[model samples]
Target: MQCPLPRIAVLWSALLFGLALSAGTTPALAQAERCPKLVAGNPFLQRLAPRTVPAAYVAPRQVGLTYIGHSTFLIETAGGVTVATDYNDYVRPAMVPRVATMNRAHSTHYSLNPDPGIEHVLKGWREDRDPVHYDLDIDDLWVGNLQTNIRDWRGDTIRNGNSIFVFRAADLCIAHLGHLHHTLTHDDIGALGRLDVVLAPVDGSYTLDIDGMIEVLKSLEAPVVIPMHYFNESTLENFLTRFAGRDYAIERRESPELVLSRETLPRKPTVIVLPPGG
Candidate 1:
């Protein structure tokens, strides 16, 4: 897992810049404090864990997420392994990801020729009738996906054509809804278990309608939801407007990247709008 030096430098610079912008009087100390030392499992994640674990807990790992325009996001784990979700030709992270997840609902959601440097390439769909399934562990990071359907170019129904990629690391379960065309059924929800964060498509017309996406969000009830796949400000605003007077709070950020740990998660359900790139 040797990452290109230029890519590592770029990510480090962006991270330091974000740290400088924090609302603390001493930026250096603030950054140091917010960036916790290496730990095992996040304590806050215990709340969402299944009943199988023991009562004691270790500190969770820290992970960073960077929006790379459209539906592509770079997810970096504390162990240094990285994953790109909904990878396509139009947008890609500067660094070659250790793993890449793809959904072929549209040209923008997948790439036919992924880089050879990537260790694992997970496709959300398959030409065969069998469902696309993935359960991969890249170091401490665990990645999986749930099958979903999509509409073909001729608007014909294609079953099990899309996937909602789930990343479990740092003691948190983060889900990316890739080109989702419909709402989740009882079984879909059951398979998803619990999601701490969700990256959702908000194009309204292209994927599920705004109302349907809203319903899907309500069903998951994740602590943090990030909007993606929207084309213009109007589309984004329309999606945000629908959440008005609801239990969700909206916050627009100037940067495309953010680091997250269970300890830093918001207490309430919040919609965070991140800029399009690092």
Candidate 2:
């Protein structure tokens, strides 16, 4: 039986399609023309920004995301459901997520001893099992995994499984292609269905190379793309160069977190640079 699309996915698809058609008539606009040029800020960039409640005129939403260094992220949906990805490193000890996802490719991606407080712990890599399937009801976050391996620096075949997580939340169907090493095939797109946002690694080393990454992104046709797994400024600059003339908007927000709704999403594919804390 085919799984039903999550409510958030349906809402996001309708909103993105409507906005795309409307935005096609108007000229492209940048979020801010004077965004600071690419520069690596200090470690102080890790502090969370002061929270300001949005006005009543805007919908009251409570989605929260915390960056736990590297590719690890802690996301709390508006419904108070918390989900974490690639929970490892010293930072993992600091996070107390309701659900945690870990991949077996690198030590940084999985914790040796799982957190005792976490209710759910998912291991993305398995030796003989098929992909793991999960349907989260608290916030309607649906996640599915595919069996894939990563290559080490020496180009040796490392037997590991990378989980491609699909999160349906807040009118957005976002896919996190965790440690993907090859271009996506036709079946992969079919499995993904419709993707509005894609979290991809653009380091051009651990994940696919620059050109390979661009190809995969094009095939997915996600309206928004967030690049991760790159260190400092130089890596981000090299990744953006691939889409120099594309009809894309680059936004470097002073804060890492953004509040997006059906009406607020952009028409074309947007690249949002979330500062460290976001």
**Model 1, poorest ten-residue lDDT window?**
25-34
**In lDDT terms, how accurate is model 2?**
0.60
Candidate 2, superposed: residue stretches over 4 Å from native: 1-63, 93-95, 128-130, 152-154, 158-160
Show pairs that collide, candidate 1.
40-59, 41-59, 41-60, 42-60
lDDT string, candidate 2, 173-204, tens digits: 66777788877655455445666667788889
lDDT of 1: 0.75
Clashing pairs in 2: 256-278
Cα distance off (Å), candidate 2, residue 61: 6.8
State the TM-score for model 2: 0.72
| Candidate 1 per-residue lDDT over residues 1-278, each given as its tens digit | 22244665564455445434432111121111111111124454334443322112223456788899899998877667678999889899998888999998888988999999998999888888356556655666767676677888788878778878888777677899999998876546645666788999998998999999999999999989999999999999999999766799999999888888878889989999999985
| Cα distance off (Å), candidate 1, residue 26 | 52
Error of 2 at 149 (Å): 2.9
Runs of candidate 1 with Cα error greater than 4 angstroms are: 1-60
Q: Give the TM-score of each candidate.
A: 0.79, 0.72
